[model samples]
Target: MPQHSPLDLAEGDPFGPHNLPYGVFTTSDEPQRRRVGVRYGAYVLDVHALAEAAGSAHAAVLSAGTLNPLLAAGRAIWSAVRAELVDALTDPARRVTVEPLLVPLADVALHLPFDVADYVDFYASEHHASNVGQIFRPNGDALTPNWKHLPIGYHGRAGTVVVSGTPVVRPAGQRKAPADAAPTFGPSQRLDIEAELGFVVGTPSTLGEPVPLDAFADHVFGVTLLNDWSARDIQAWEYVPLGPFLGKSFATSVSAWVTPLDALAHARTAPPRRDVPLLPYLDDSAAAEPGGFDIRLEVAINGHVVSRPPFSAMYWTAAQQLAHMTVNGASLRTGDLFASGTISGPRPEERGCLLELTWSGRDPVELPTGKRTFLEDGDEVTITAWAPGPDGVRVGLGEVTGKITGR
Candidate 1:
C-alpha cells in the first residue's frame, strides 16, 4: 500500500521500501526491558515516546501499559499502531511526529517483544519432513500416516526461546561411534542451524473452542525468522518414541523484529500444490487467497553470501497450519510461538539447513572460501527476506544474524 521503492530499497534490504517489523528494545544503557519500538531501515523508532509526544494519535495504542497489551488487542490495534508509525517515520514533512523516538540499531538491546506463554513448532514442510523421516524410518513409511491429514508439531520449551543475538551454547549430549560400540557422552559435534519462520499469536482463544480456519489470520500478530538449532547426534539417540527433547531445546534464535502481516499483506502469493485434499476443518479459504508471498529468504556465512531461496517453496501454507492447530480447540495465548519447519528447496543446493544442504555432512557445503561440514566457531549466519509491492515501499524481514562461538 505504501511505496518508497527503487530509491529507498537496496535490492535485498529487509527494512527497505515495503517491510516494517516491530520489536521491543531499549538502549543498551537502559537497565530494564520495556516494550519500546519498531524497526525501520536500520533503526528502532520510539513508539512509547511517540505516544508521550503525539498524545492523541498514539494514545489509542502506543500509550498502553506495554506492547503485549496492544498485541492482545488484535489486528485492529496493530494496524492502527503500524499505520501511525509508518506515516510518522517515513514522511519527512511530518517532522514533529517523527522527532520523539529514534535510535540507531547499534544502540539497542532487543528483547522478546511479548511474553511467550507456550511454543509449538510445526513440521509442515513436505520436503523437510520426507527427508528427515528417511534418515530414521528408512522403510515402513516415509511420512507418518496422519502427516498428510494434519499439521504435525511438537510442544517446544517456551522458556528457552530468546531473541536474536542471544548466544546458543554448543549442546552436550551422547554421540555413538561405531568403534566405541556404545554411546559416548560429549559436546555435540553436529550443532547446526535450521532456517525457519515463526508466527506469533496476537490473541487468546477459549479452551475446547476451535478457532475457525477463516479467522486464523486475525489471531496471528506477526512473523519472524527463527533458528531452531539442532544437535543431530544427540537427537538420533534420544528421539525414540517421543520427539525432540534436550537435543532441540537448548536455545532458539529469532529476529528482533516481528513483521506484521498487515504491512506485508500485499506480498501474499498462492500456496503450492495440494498434495492431498485437506479435511474440512483443515480446509481454509485464506490458504487459497494468495496464501503465499514472494518473500525471498537468504543466508550468509561469516558475512559471506549464500543462496537466496523464496518462501514460496513451502508446500503447506502457514494459514493451513494455524487453522489445523485449532481443530482440537487448543487455546493459543496472546504471545504463543510457532515455527515453520526448516524451509528446504527441491534442489539439494537450495536446502535451508546445513543438515539438509550437506546431506547430514556426507556432502559438505562449499562456501566462498571453502567447504563446510557444519557451522564452525567464528562463523556468522544471517537470514533475511523481503518483497516488493505497490510504490516500491517494500516490506522486509530485517537480517536475523547470529555468530557461532566456542562452547
Candidate 2:
C-alpha cells in the first residue's frame, strides 16, 4: 500500500500520492512555454519547482515543456524521480517547500504530454474482435485463424493524434453501396469510437534488438485512456486488401494525464487462457506476474452511460504485444504509443462501441438525446476507467472525451 501525502485526497481520488501522473500544461500566467506537472488530487504540482526544491538531478529535464526528455532518460532515472516525488509529497518535513508549487488544475490547460514518434493500435480484445467478426462476417469464424497466435496490429497516424476534449470533425471518404455503380464521396455516416488503453514507450531501443517480455515495465512509462475514432461505412468499402486507412486516420483522442506503471501494480490480474500454441517470441512466462489489469472502463454518450468494458478481459497482454512488436527487430523511440483495441467484455451491455452494441447498424441504441445508429453531430462520447488500488481503494484514469462536428 502507498503512504498518504500531505494533501488530503478523497476516497476515490485518482491522483493520489500513489498515482502522481505526468502531463504538460500551460497556465494563463505563462502560456508561452508549456511546463511539466504532476497531478495530485485537484492540483497540479510544478515538476520543475519541485525538482529544484528537492535539489534533484532531474530538475533540468523537469523544467522543459514536455515529457520526452524524461522519458528518454530510461528506467533508472524514472525510478529515482518517482521516488523523489513520493517523498516530497508524503514527507511531513517537506510540506512547506512543496505547498508553494501546487497549482489548481482548473487554472491550467493540459496539452499533449509527449511528441508522438509513432502510433500502433492493436486488436487484443477477444470479445471486441469476436463481435466485430460476427457482425461483419457472420458465415466466418468469430476468432480469426491467426488471432490467438499473434497480436494483430496496424500503424496509425501519430501526427493527427490529439489530446482529450479536442473536437472531432466527421471524416469524409468514398463510400459505395452494393447496388451503386460508383463510390460516392461524402462525410462518413457511421462514425464510431473504440475505447482502449494506451501504453507509452519511455526508453528507446536499438534497431536490431528485441525487448523481452520481462522488460515490459522497464521500457513503458505509463498508460492512458484512448479513443480510436472509426468510420464504419468507409471502412467497409476500403478494408478488403489492406486494413484501416481514412476510416481510422482522421483523429484519435487521448487523456492528458499518464498514470505510471508503478501506480497500477495492485491492479494487475491474470489473463485468460490462450487457444493457440504460442511461438517462443510470444511466450508469456511471467504467469505469476500480472498479465492484465482489472480496470473497469465505461463509455458514455451525451452524459448517458452506455457500456462497461473490462480491461482485464483483453486476450493479448501488454507484455506480449511489446515483445511481438520488437521480435522483428523493429526499433522503439521514446514517444511510441501502442493501444489495446476496443476493450469489450463478454456480455451485451459491455460492448465498447456503437458498432457492436447496435449489431452493425441492425440495432440502434436509444440515448437520452435521441436514438443513435451511429454518432450524430453535437453528440459527445466520453470514456473513463477505474482500477483496484491498494487496500481495496480505487484509482481512476480521468477520461478522453470528444464531440462530433460536421466536416
Candidate 3:
C-alpha cells in the first residue's frame, strides 16, 4: 500500500492530511498581522490556536513567536510541525487541539505567507521562451545564448508582492513607441498577467554558499500560485541592456497557502527536453531526478470566469532554480522567492498567459459571453492548482484572484 497523509487524500490530492502547508490569514474583522494555518479539505487550520491546544506537543517550537521563527529552525522542526498538526487537527482521535481555529477557507481572506526577503523571477521554461522569441525574432534564434548555460532570472520587487485577493491597482508608467518619439506618462493601457509558480525557501543558506541539487528540497518551504501582472508597453520600452524596471514593479500577486513538497511527492515527472545540452550545474538530474513534481496548474478570468485546463509545462523544476540561484554563492533567506516564469506548453490550448494565448494581442480569446484581448476593467484573473483527481483530496491552495479596476 502507498504511504499517504492521515487525511483522506485521493490519489491526486495535493494537500492530503499528510501535507500541512503553512500560510497567513485574517478575517474581515481581524487584524492585518496574520496568523499561521494549514489547508485541509476546504478549511484553514489556525496553527497558533492549534499550538495552544497541543501545548506539550507543540511547546518547544510554538514559543518561537511566529512561523517565520520556526521556519528558520530547519527541516526537522518543519517535519515536526506538520506531523503534530496531522495527528491533532486531521484525526478526530487527537482532536483536542483542533477547536477555535477552524476557519472556512471560503470565508477568510488569505495573505502572503511570509515577508518575501527577495524575489527572483526566472525565464526557465524553454518552450515559452522559444514561442515568444519566435514571435518576436522569427528570423533568428529562439533562445538567447546565456539561457542555455544558466537559469535566466531577474530580481523583482518584494515590496510590491501582495496576497491574492488584494485589489491590483492598475499601475502608472511610461510608454515609448520609437526612440525618435518622446515617452508618455500615464496609467498602463496594455495591462496583462503572467501565469507563474514559485517556491518559498525555508532554510537559510549563507552568502556565497551554493545550495546543491539534492538539498534543494530541504531549502524549499512550499509552493504558491503567482500572477505576475505585466505592463507590456512599459516593459518593452525600459527593459533592454537592463531588465524589467518600473513596468514589472508595481505589483505581483501570490496565493495564500504554501503547498508542501511532501504532498506532491508522488506527482514527480520529468519535463520534456530540448536539443541543447544543459550546463554541468544545470544537468538533467538537477532539473528532474527520475521525476519532479507534475502538479496541474489552472487559470480563470472574471467572476463568471472561464477556467483553462491544467498542465505542468515548466522547463525547469523549483529545485533546479534554487540550486541555480545560489550557484554563485547568493544567500537564500527564509522568505526568498523563485518563480517559474510563464508556464506554456507546445499546444495553443495549453498557453498560460494572455500574451501567448492572444498571440501578443493579435488574436483575442473569446469568453463564454464575448470580448477579449488581454484583461479589461472589472476583469478578474484566478490561478489554482492540485495534484490531480478528487479521491484522496488534499488541501488545495484554493485560488489567487485579482480584478482589473479602471485607472
Best by TM-score: 2
For candidate 1, write residues 287-372 as lDDT tens digits.
Answer: 44666666777877776655565677777677777777877878888888888878877666567778777777888877886788
- Give the lowest summed-lDDT range of ten residues in model 2: 3-12
Per-residue error at 86 for model 2, in Å?
1.2
**Of candidates 3 and 2, the better by lDDT:** 2
Summarize candidate 3's per-residue lDDT along 143-255 as a digit string, tens digits.
88877677788999999988888888888888987564698998887788888887888889989889877887778877888888998888878899899988888888988
Give the distance in Å from residue 314's predicted Cα in candidate 1 to where it truly belongs.
Answer: 1.3
In model 2, residue pairs whose N, Cα or C atoms come closer than 3 Å (at least 3 residues apart or on different chains), thus clashing, are none
State in Å the error of residue 6, model 3: 15
Query: What are the per-model numbers of colliding residue pairs?
Result: 10, 0, 10
Order by lDDT, highest first: 2, 1, 3
Every candidate's CA RMSD:
3.8, 2.8, 4.3
Segments of candidate 3 deviating more than 4 angstroms: 1-15, 28-33, 57-66, 178-180, 286-288, 303-311, 389-395
TM-score of 2: 0.97
TM-score to true structure, per model: 0.89, 0.97, 0.89
Residues forming the 10-long window of minimal summed lDDT in candidate 3: 303-312
